[model samples]
Target: MFRISSVCLCLFASLAIADESSKPGRLTVAQKNGWATYDTELKKKEDAVNKACGSAVKSSYDRSTYPAFDPMKDRTQSACQMAVGTLVEVCRTPDGKAAVKEAVTKTVCRLSTEGTKVSLDGSVLTIHIDPEKSSIVGKEPGSYSWKSALEEVL
Candidate 1:
């Protein structure tokens, strides 16, 4: 009888959690505008980095060879690292730095509504979103804004 009661309680608790998560997440007008701006800036930066890296890789390959140069072997990983380096370089500039700070601040403010914790140790930046008490982790090196913000918050 006790075992059956415990099982029912566990089931009810799980259902309640699921119901909460199923509800849509809402953002204010300011947050929506901020997110749009961030999205556009992010896309522009990504395109620049990708174009630079792609050109470098293509030029490095010998297209004249009989066997078409296959750059896919571990190229993606290397390209990604190069892109990160490029992003870091961009972040070092005054304008880039300011953009990053503004983006981070806006993002943190939006996420704060759902409870967010941000931390940066060396190159790794960890963000914990407490909507459902789940954590998302990402690592990037030499992001000054990340370091500064983390220091200020934590």
Candidate 2:
């Protein structure tokens, strides 16, 4: 009876340790800084893409009548394609590429606690919040609001 009790206690202790180890911990100072840097870089990229897309739309319409034209109506599939193309180009640089990769990895790490999965295809980023639901960013043209999505997730 004494040996059986000891074995059971050991198993219980191991299980507790395993569970604790699986839990996500707080980010370190360096990790926080890295995330901030990534956020800044992403913001810059978004601004650039938005500017380009805005210009494209503005140029497509007559200047005098532009005010009457609804911009939302212009945000079609082609506009999204252009935005994605611009995003792909912007991240083609070595520094931009590294920043984007690090951001995505960090986001995945942070969301792992909720069993979230993130995937990127071109500029369209998808965050699988759960098995039944997901949130997407950069999928819509003129809507490069990734920061908002990150805020919602965090």
Candidate 2 per-residue lDDT, tens place, 8-94, comes to: 999999999999876655655754554455445444544554453331111111122122223333222232233233433545556
Give the local distance difference test score of model 1: 0.38
Range of the 10 consecutive residues with the lowest summed lDDT in candidate 2: 55-64
Error of 2 at 136 (Å): 18
lDDT (0-100) at residue 138 of candidate 1? 28
Candidate 1 lDDT, tens digit per residue, 50-149? 3432311111211122122122321222322232334344455566544434332211111222433455444333333333332322233333332343
- How much lDDT does candidate 2 score? 0.38
RMSD per candidate (Å) reads 17.6, 18.2
- In model 1, which regions exceed 4 Å deviation? 1-25, 55-85, 88-154
Off by over 4 Å in 2: 55-85, 88-154
Q: What's model 1's lDDT at 120?
A: 40
TM accuracy, model 2: 0.37
What are the lDDT scores of the predictions, listed in order?
A: 0.38, 0.38
lDDT score for residue 42 of model 1: 42
